[model samples]
Target: MNKLSVKVKNLVIGGNSPIVVQTMCNTHTQDIEASIAQCKDMVAAGTQMIRLTTQGLDEVNALRVIKEQLHAAGIHIPLVADVHFNSDVAIAAAKVADKVRINPGNFAQVHKDAAVQFKKFLEICKENNTAVRIGLNHGSLGEEIVNKYGNTPLGMKEAVMQWLSMCKENDFYNVVVSLKASNTVVMTEAYRLLHNAMQEDGMLFPLHLGVTEAGNGDQGRIKSAVGIGALLKDGIGDTIRVSLTENPVNEIPAGHTIANFFESGENEILLDSVMAQIRRGSSKPEAIISVNSALCGNTDTRSQDAWNEFIIKASCLFGPLLLDKQIDDFDAVPNFSHAHNHDHECEHTNEHSSDHESNDAEEQIFVEMKKIFSADRLVEFKENLMQAARRKFTHPEYIACPGCGRTQYNLEQTFNEVKRRTAHMKGLKIAVMGCIVNGPGEMADADYGYVGQGGHKVTIYKGKTPVLKSVPEDQAINALIKIISES
Candidate 1:
């Protein structure tokens, strides 16, 4: 497939260019000063493209001022207007933003009406030379497509193809495409299907890669790496975003690590050594023990760089294996004498020493490993890897959007509270979303949703039905828990 390069301002995506790393602002777009400040910080953090939520004409107009100020300050990075459920705003934004992202599913309730709106949107974008990102996410596939294709990867591919066909019919080529999902398996499969279909059709659009609503911290990074890394390794991604439920600035480096891991051979060498050892089967435990010891031994997990490298390498190594079902789980010591007998207190030895005296070589290594990577942390890693791969759910699955300008409440704080309160609930898919426009639909298959509805209010939903409408912010979590408890 010959891929066309998309030009958003001076930055280019696809067509032999390096993978573009991008992020979106979490500040309210209407707050011109805050949005501009955030944009400058994003640029300083190495963001190639920054997207701001333009939920209406007001936000769109604010975006215009934001872009002008950014350019005036010589921050020439492209600004993308994120518009949903409002085609008129998108059309107006086409004149202002360097790029516009629209979810076709929410562009209109009716598919035909969406097509009509999108055609008009394309005309304006073409007139202004603005780029468009046909962003379609899983769990948000329109009813018509879901009924026919069952909300699967095929449905995601089919839905996007219709819009791509429309773009071709309208002769608009300045476009990129994305198919994101919080589930790594679903996300990877959707992109693969779309890539193959586009290859067969001979009109491939540049792909924007992301694992949407992946919660923050190590789990989020691992999940994004597993989904994005798999496709990137297969030569399928163009631009990438690591969506974390944290400060948007943090996404830049996380994204760079994933992109650079592929460019550099360091991670591949690490993975190959482990794979070879696993394949030998002669001393699998010895191989894993040695690798873990080398990687984590004498390593301070406190340093951001060290932690990032360790997690990224671990994700690259174990995430793909788990996702493909090649391995069920990972254990650093499977053949040790103390495998099932070791106590967390290290009762038989000094707890502070990595150089504890032990007759068994495996025991010595195991003790050292437990010191560096605690037993609890190792277990946590395994569980995180399993959940990220969609193989198991030892903890509550959180689908949280990296809050945007459209966000009304304190999303990160609210999501953390939600996780803290619901920590005991296992195997449940819960979503803590930021706003109503994309919240309900993007939460996808989450069994429960806590969606923010501006003015310091929230609506708790049980699988798309609002159980508590306009609940006060302070009482929202309690209400959500109450509903869940009742259910």
Candidate 2:
């Protein structure tokens, strides 16, 4: 692919440059102050570019004011004017804005001079040396293309190709192409196919990425991340936006997160792994505790105090029991036989005579809990709880396993019941793991959970901490509900 050098302020799109994160302002562009303030917020949050809707002359008027304010503040980020329906707005915005985005499907005339008028708009943009973006949305495809190919990825791609062809025919190579769809699967698949097609044809058009109308907050962020993040992993997108129904400023963070995925290679650890790791205990001892002694170089008092408190609580819960040889070496420990007998024996003896021990079981339990409850562990537990709570209360999240004969309850049925009951919640996470062997670890991050044990028995946890065990099968949901409600 040839390097792209379409200038937006001082930043260049495409080529070896870092991915550009962009978002559209949700405020009425006619309100210059509101639009300028929102743009300032987006700039502060690391947005590389911003687009404002330019419906006609009135919005164009606001654009002029916005340009003045941006210049006064010395903010030089590229500003794109989003135009539709009228070529006049596009022509007018090209006079002042950094770039002008046009939807070809709507930029038409009802008379014989339509083509002439459209050419005039392009000529004006060319004269001003402003770049153009040919943005094609699946929701607003031209009637001819939709009728020929239906509303599939193929149709969206065709619409974009047609626009690009027009730009090429008119010698407008300073253009970007975006083929967007709201469906995550379609959006991702279409971009992949189009990207390949463009490569095969030697078309080096810079691609702008987005998933349109992606709801609000977590849902929107998740959908955009999955769609845009996937393409970015393959080195396909050059610019991106996260379209949400909420405040436009919120979109800036989401865009930056996606861009940073490609810029820093952080998405490899972020996707499908953050939640999983939170469920499984960390492999490193340093991950288990977050201490702030001068030796460790931590000076934050709040973090140090939190670490101390957690250690105290965890030690209190498990300290005495671990000190008892019988309980410490019990079969409950997974892979007890895998360790070298000498090492296992050493671990057992160390716990028994350790300074963490107490004569009283209750006191020992608290001490043990505290020892295990370092700041890192506490933070991990809280993250898990928040994820489970969000899933339980909001969307369809599952806690299934690699099934075995020990399983009694229908895991799928339990999952559906919990999801249905908690769908009204905005941020609830519930887990339904199969058996006690792996249930506690699997449901460690859930806000409320149910794990099937032997016949008719279930264990419940509220955010990694076990609240109740051995509740009968019939009362599991009710128990979980009560715990979640109280929490």
**Model 2: how far residue 101 lies from native, Å:** 1.3
Clashing pairs in 1: none
Candidate that would win on lDDT: 1
lDDT of each: 0.82, 0.61
lDDT over C-alpha atoms for residue 487 of model 1 = 92
Candidate 1 is scored at a TM of 0.87
User: In model 1, which regions exceed 4 Å deviation?
Assistant: 110-112, 282-301, 332-375
Give the number of the best model, judged by TM-score: 1
Residue-by-residue lDDT tens digits, candidate 2, 396-486: 3433332222345765466557757876665555566666754564342456667788778888887777789889988998898888888
Question: Per-residue lDDT of 71-139 in model 1, one digit per residue for the tens?
Answer: 899788899999866888899999999999999777745445777888999999999999999999997
